[model samples]
Target: MMSYQKFARDVGFIGIVQILTSLSSFFLLPIITKTLGAYDYGLWAQINITVSLISSLALMGLSMSFVRFLSSETDQNKIQEAVYSILFFVTVSGFLASFILYIFAEPLATFGFKDPEATYFVQAGSLLILVSVVESISLFYFRIFRQIEKYSYFTFFETFGKLLIILILLKMGYGLIGVIAATLIVQGIIFLITLIIIISQIGFIIPRFTYIREYLQFSLPLTPNSLIRWVTESSDRYMVTYFLGLGSVGVYSAACSVGNLIQFFVSPLQLILFPELSKLFDHNKMDEVRIYMSHSLRYFLIIAIPAVFGLSALAKPLLSVLTTQDFISGWFVIPIIALAGLMAGIFQIFVNTMFLIKETKPATYINIVAAVTNVLLNLILIPIPSIGILGAAFSTLVSYCLMAAFCVHISLKHFKLDFYYLDIAKSILSSMAMYFFVSSFTISGILELFEAAGVGTIVYLIAMFLIGGFTDHEVSLMKKYLFRSKVNPSTK
Candidate 1:
């Protein structure tokens, strides 16, 4: 019985949490960049990419399946069945993966970093895979249950705590090792905290193996999708590191991080939208599902379009202030990566259509195509002296565009959203307007960047309003949600 207003409010709250999380990371980037320098930072990036790749593989997509299966279930026993089943499987897989990574640490370091000295970091990073799986599944439980406030608290604490620990370790002269250790310690701590909270809420249960086969059937198809997504999103860093150098990887990663700010805008919607849509689709509420899908895309574009534009226009100054001159070349890659982020966001929306219908094979197929395309293009382009990291950035943008187009086409056969072409056009035009105004300013430092951003945002909003980017009804709805008292719907 979640009302539209309540949903909006939840999205807003989660959006704030996302903003804080992004900001915390944003703030930490400079510290790490300045402290570790490009080569070490690049190594750190590769380590993280490895962690994500292995962790995703080990989870076998069970985290997503948990949300899919458990979100609408009322049977407490069945809920426990889903929860404990996923936890047990993921825990065993996680530790096994961690052990393998630890045992193969040297070769992995040599392969990924071209430096055997990185073996210690690789061994330390192996621990992250185990703890992170638990953390992820626990958070997924919070999300499926719609305990957004508790979710937000844990998310913020983990993010902020990691930053604080990393900073202190760096100050203590732990250097690159400090960063890796911080990640492991912080994730392990948060994993324990979240585990306690979940157990307290749901109590403990020895999971029956009854649902294991069913869960595996639902989740197994998505394993390739997860791996391929890793390739699309992260394998490029490995390529960059291999082709150019860790310094180049570091520079590319900086731009990618900045561009990833687009996620803060879209991810909150994606997070809330999936479970909501799953429940709606489960109940045969196709009309509501369609409305949610259409509005989700439109609303995402309304913010993301301008963000991509503004960030692209201000990339030079922003990078100059945030990172050292060594990483400033990365500014060139920001616009391409930012647009890729937008495409990634759209891809998430379309893929939800696949998730809702339980036809996940298409998602795996689409990702395979995109991931292969990205790898081939990166190999072909990154070696060309003229392209280098720009090739990686362009490869990302092209692959995501391909994925989005393919997903949209496939999703239409099952459930076609209005696509909202005109509204999207408005968003693009408004963003362009914002870009022109923002780029006109001569920016040198943080203050000027802030000033230009403020002025650009104001101009974008005024232009959007004049160009009918938002309807009166939509604006009224926003006002009602933001200014009015909370509207509590009857429990579902």
Candidate 2:
């Protein structure tokens, strides 16, 4: 088993890379929205969401299963074989996905957009599924190999490539098509590059049919659950597009853009937690697993609670400066959705624990129920102009809240573990104190953001310190990590 400190460092490395990418996106969004306008932005968003749905299927739950199973394998030779086999599975899935999209490209395109030109965007976006599948597989492999530095390298390259392409094309007056085209081009390039690097690192070999079967045995059962999760996760954009039209969808998508920035912090937590928790489960260390769960929940809520409240409070000024006036309508949705992200992030840590214990059935069941509820709520609420994008945001809130509660109930019943409510309450109280501190600043735009964030950080630190959120021993460990010299800066 890896040391908690080392595991944290690895997760932090990935988190920093992800945060950089997210920052780039946040900075670029206003430029993209202004250049494309509402209708074009909406179209691009709809196409992307549609492509996301397909890519979820293209992934077919194999990536998560790959991480879990690959981490569990002990033998070097067998691990190599398993990696090659999973690679083969993903390649085949990608091809199958691309072909299906090609066959139904026209129907899928026109069904949502009702324009023939939109077909081209759909076709282009469909290819991104294959690219993303390949890229996810490569990244998971990198994680298993402990190639932390290379993982960061690929992450930045992927984000940078997409950013550069979008900026150049948007400047060239390509509009929404430019956005979709840029995604396709950049993802393709990154996928190829990562594949080449991985092949070089491992020396690729073609696996036999039995190797494929071994992977599928573990991977295939998880697909329905993955599909259900994708639906629940991406349903908001699709629901808005279907019920509210392209323009409304764009507005909600803009709101979600800000919300997704929170994921830069959450994703690395999930990545680290999933494998780490799986290891604990494999060893039957329920006590350590509970401690990790409590710690993860506390840490994430501390970061996210203020983030949601502060960002929402400052959304108007931030959007005005970062994006055009057109995007200001999304301002109202930010706080609501940001709060949703806070709840969802806490939920994700606990939900992932179910996977560790192989209690996936309940997770799948409740998510399906949640997904259905979201679609129904969108259909009922979107036509009311007063609700508008807020309705879409609320649908997500309701769905995830329901799913989170269900997951917690199931985990308790099946595993006899507790989520440590005292820890959660302390984090929440600290975060709320921090939020109020940050929101008290009387300013607007970027300056307001910096000032508020600065005050909030100091206040959060003081509050955590006063509240005894960290043990003295934990603080000493943190000091050692920060001050000690090391050959690899990441390891420190």
lDDT of 1 by residue, 408-444 (tens): 8998887768877888899889888889888889988
Residue 106, candidate 2: alpha-carbon lDDT: 86
lDDT of each: 0.88, 0.74
Q: Write the per-residue lDDT of candidate 2 for residues 1-492, one digit (tens) a residue.
A: 877777778877888898789767876787788888777788888767666777767777778777777676777666667777777777888878887887777886677665566777677677777877877887887776667788788778878878888899988988777877887787777677877887786677776545556556666666777677667667677667776777777777887888756656787788777787788778888888877776676667667766776676677766776777777888888877777677677678878766676556777788789889888887788778788778888888888788878877776664555555665576667778876666666765666667777787777767877887765655665566666633444443
Q: Model 1: how far is 151 from its true place, Å? A: 1.2
Q: TM-scores, in order shown?
A: 0.95, 0.91
Clashes of each: 0, 0
How much does candidate 2 score in TM-score?
0.91
Off by over 4 Å in 1: 477-492
Lowest summed lDDT window (length 10), candidate 2: 483-492
